[model samples]
Target: MADSPLPDKLDNARVLIYSHDTFGLGHLRRCRTLAHALVEQYKGLSVLILTGSPIIGRFDFKARVDFVRIPGVIKLHNGEYTSLGLHIDLQHTLKLRESIILHTAEAFEPDLFLVDKEPLGLKGEVESTLKLLKQKGVATVLGIRDVLDAPHLLRPEWESKGAGAALQEYYNEVWVYGDRSMGNPLEGLGLPAQIEQMTHYTGYLQREVPESVPSKHLLGVPQNYLLITPGGGGDGVEMVDWALRAYELDSSSLPHGLFVLGPFMALAEQQAFRERISRIENASLVTFDNRMESLIDNAAAVVAMGGYNTFCEILSFNKPALLIPRTRPREEQLIRAEKASDLGLVSLLDPRKGIDATEMHRALQALLKQSPPRELVADCFLNGLDKVCQRALALMPRS
Candidate 1:
């Protein structure tokens, strides 16, 4: 990475990231990735991530990157959110979150405020914080993923949350972490001309193999395996079931499979997978691993839900991948999978068409021998981190 131009002033610059983190590990993980990258690029830059993920403590942070844990909220299957642990009602919980966020911004006094995905934040919890930060002259940015839900679903949802108004009033810029070749995530949102002008496409964020690698003995990593992950595994039961069934149906044709069931996956689901994996000679299960990049780096191929972070890693590592994107709650993954598949970056097996075990088996086998992504796309696709750093430098005020 290029060195920051204003290193002397960078020591005093700080970036605060807000990750709503209501459902899966996606928000927290993406924030962590950006935090790490920013600190690495700018030598004394401090990145503080404010998150509501219950398992935020599980992952490691770099020297200049840290996190402040707010009260947790969990999104239900029915699209409602409830406090993850507190017995307080949703209203009380949201108030508590709002207060915490506002106080953190006041205390931290960040040079830049980056909000992940949610424009107004979870139930508008970050609205007060955004307003306060704006008055304090903090450069506010909205970092959205490559694809949000379908336009129809996202438009109504954003309208209900007053996202458009929030963007127009508070945020200084909107950063789309994707390439235009893939698709425009905000295609039909109908933002005003000014907001559209503020938008910048930073391509896809690229991941690297971590500097430190844990011993295989410590992680119990199997040899020459295929990595099958469903992101946080909150809604991954069906994907796991299909993969296991594929193995049970025919294991002789496939390589050893390492399943990383995420921490948020239910206890019952983990136990069931454990029992099933024990019976299958070619399959093994791990509940969760913070060092996921290392595992993906060593894997022969990958099968995953095609979430943003995982997709970046697959492209970064140049692994042949088979994506089975979920269509419920949001079509983000499905949209991503379709676009990447069309570009020949990854193969897609749409669940909307019904995922048959036989088809899954065939896909996995094909994936193991398929060409890696690097052969197809230019190197510019993974240049998101560098572009983001450039934007950050431009946004920060010089001393």
Candidate 2:
């Protein structure tokens, strides 16, 4: 792009990221991390994120990175989606979202396009945009998390949406932010050999928390206390509540439990959690923190619901984490937790089988006594940001 006589700086090369955020903050977080990483790597590089995440404004952004907030949609428990606040029909809302996305890409004229997860996006909202970008010779990338839904669920879901076809035609490269020994996000989809060859395992994304940021003391959490979280907290009520329940059972054993309830959790449930916190002596609560990387950094050990970004943070920080993975909604988290536990990267509690308060306490105690688990640290790669930046720059010439 810099070679096109546009601007002198190599930062003239830009990247456009799309996140079809149906539910949680995972998609948005991953995109923002990548945007920040790329911007930091190049002097004049600029990154624009097109996202439907409701809480996108809550986080601070880097100088060369910003976001365009697309109209949001919420996924219902019944698997149907509704406009976040608009009275318009879901179809009409999607049309509006599509227009904003396509128009932004056209105006931004990025040298590279990174589409998160869903190849075609929600109901194929990003399809036209993908087509137009490719026609303009944009290097389109599909940046998927380590594990998508289990193969059985993912295959049919992709087939129904015709995502396989888009992957074959629109995208130039498929980057899986995980190690292959973990699991392929596209396994069992029966992708053609060419599509498979286009895929690259970029390893787990590495996250860092700046040391100068406000400390855990701000949350009333003492040093050496357990840090517990459910990233974005909408679907994490079960796990978050379980931590509170465990604390209630024995505050002495698990003193000073710090719970960062994500903003997406239902108000009533958050209020319920607050009521429990008021009754408990040692535990404190904060609704949300944009810089959760800092919280994870200072953690004695982490108890997290296994989301991709959370897992990445745990891996990068080398925090001893206990995962309580949700079985329903998609088996991706469950599968990831199981494998990570097998590798001794972290431990897990299967929500389906439902370990009780005593078992939860035992896990917490074990974590305090033990060095944070890291049997496979050398085996897995967490330097994905560097690789992504390299691949992205190579797509566009510097000179």
Candidate 3:
């Protein structure tokens, strides 16, 4: 392999991160953490993130890190998508996204391109942009979470779409943001052993919460309140609804429940939920919160859908949690929840099998009354941002 042409001077290095946060917050949030870590570790290095999150401005970012927001699009159940607004069509949105990506790369001329999760880039939108970057002799990498999905489900999809081939040809390195001992995301991709050599496990990257930050919700609520969250609220309506129903049917004196309907939750759905749950004295609904770690840390227990970022937050906070993962499209959450449960870190419930009010109440009771198993608190937890930043910096071009 040839060495990269990027300048050796750290002050001249520019890094660009691409995160397609089309439907959820996990991808974007992960990229932000990485960008911050990279900038902090490599002095004088500047970072830019290209994201499709409509609410990108809502979050706080460290200095020298910035983002360019792409037009929003939402995927429907039938595998089709539409622009998020009345003015933009799907084609226009794609074009706009492509233009912004290309323009950013051209202007910034980043020495490294770290792409999050999406290999083909936003339904294949970034292919041309990547080609352009490669032509400019820029180094590119793909950063994936521990589990994209079950191997069986992910294999055929990648094979049919030539995703594996794209990664092999375009990406200089593939960083799995998880330990392989937990699970190998690339096991069934049919790639050769040489491809495995290009892979590096960076362990899990978690946001560090300051110990002194106090939680507002923890102020008056008794020690029994359980925090319920659906990440981004795009596909989390069912889980939130189930939890609310459980609170309504409580025969025992129920703990106060705080539900955070993420920012992306539909207006109609939010209004409906508010109407239904407003009458319940124990339930409080709020929009998406950036300071979720504080809330999670102070909570007595947690009920959530099993997204990777949310799962990590639950683990880091060391709170007893009940995970109700989604079943269809992909079983990423289900796989993570089951593994964590096997490790005795948390409880898992299947919504399809009928998780009613009684079950929710019982699960909450058990979790609050008992501590998470000892095995759950083992060395599986990682704080790996520094190590990942080191590796990324090493991969940058030397003068």
Candidate 4:
């Protein structure tokens, strides 16, 4: 491992990150975090992130890190997707994306290529790029979260999609941002033993919050305010509506509720929710904030949809969380929330089971009254970027 050809100098080192942020902010955020860490740790490292998020420009990024935004697409209830007027079809979008990625690779001539979440990219968009990088002798890696899904669910899906084969042949390393004792993401991928040596459990990546910020919205809220969040707000409307209704029906249980309706939530849905919750004196609604870490840090408890990023934030702040995960499309959130609940890290409520005023009230009461288990808070801070940076550095071409 020590003999690996990582670059020693930070200057002139180029790193490319590929993040397929189709739906929510998790993948993009993770990539951004990794980019920031690399640039900060290595003074002259330049990082370029290629992402498909519609709201890429909304957030601020570090100095050495920049992103190229691909055409956006949204998933509909019928399981079909439509583009944001930028492309005629998903195929066109993929072609454009491929061109942009390849062009970026050619221009940047990256020393390392770190792909977030998607192993083979958006339906194998990165296959050609991976081949190009291999030919060019660029180090390639895959960054994955702790728990992708149940083994049974993931096995057939990956097999059918040829993701397993891609993993076996393409990526040089598989970095899991979680502990394997908790769960192993590659267990069912059925790769050869040589592939296992390329895997690393890099713990969880965490966002560090400053001691104070000048933002008045999160400044010293009243003692007992419950914080409600839905990550990117694309799929959070249902959870937000349920929480508002729960508060409306049982205002006595929840004295105050602060709803951070994510920026991406539909305008009509946001308006209706705001109007409905306005009548409830205990509830106050606001739009998204990049400084959500501060808000979560000061909250009494959290009621949210179980996105991996949000779950990590809640755990980092040691806030008691009530997770209402989405089912049907992807069971990632459901699997995580259930496992966390089993470990007593949080209270998982099934959206299918129906969240009534009674259940909400009971759960909130218990969380606020009881102390969250200490083990739930054990070593949850995973500063994985440093390790990843070191690994990438090790893989870089030595002078």
Weakest 10 consecutive residues of candidate 4 by summed lDDT: 1-10
User: Which runs of model 2 end up more than 4 angstroms from their true locations?
Assistant: 1-9, 215-219
lDDT of 1 by residue, 1-399 (tens): 434453433777899999989988999888998998888878789999999999999988999898899999998888898999899999999999999999989999999999999898998888889888888888999999989989999998888888888999998899999888988888898878888889999988988766675535235656678889998999888888888889999998888889899988999999999999999897888888887888888899999999999999999888999999899888999999999999999998988889888988888889887999989887677788888988999999877
TM-score, cand. 2: 0.95
Report the lDDT tens digits of candidate 2 across residue range 292-359.
88888888889998899999988877788899998887898999999998888888888898878888
lDDT of each: 0.88, 0.85, 0.79, 0.78
The lDDT, on a scale of 0 to 1, for candidate 3 is: 0.79
Candidate 1 wrongly placed segments (more than 4 Å) = 1-9, 215-222
| TM-scores, each model vs. reference | 0.96, 0.95, 0.91, 0.92
Per-model clash counts, in order, read 0, 1, 1, 1
User: In terms of lDDT, which candidate is strongest?
Assistant: 1
lDDT accuracy of residue 123 in candidate 2: 91
lDDT of each residue in 104-164, candidate 3, tens digit only: 8899999899998878787788888799988988889999988888888888888877788
Off by over 4 Å in 4: 1-9, 214-216, 373-381
lDDT of 4 by residue, 1-399 (tens): 112233434887889999877777888877887887788777788999998887789878888899998777666777666776573888888788888888889989999999987778877888889999989988899889887876777888778778867877788898988655457777776767876898888766666664466346755456668989998888887788777777777787665888999888889998998898879877788887876777888788888888878876776677788889987577778877887787777888898887776777777677676555335544633546556777877887755
User: How far in Å is the alpha carbon of 37 misplaced in model 3?
Assistant: 1.8
Residue pairs with backbone overlap in model 3: 8-399
Ranking by lDDT: 1, 2, 3, 4
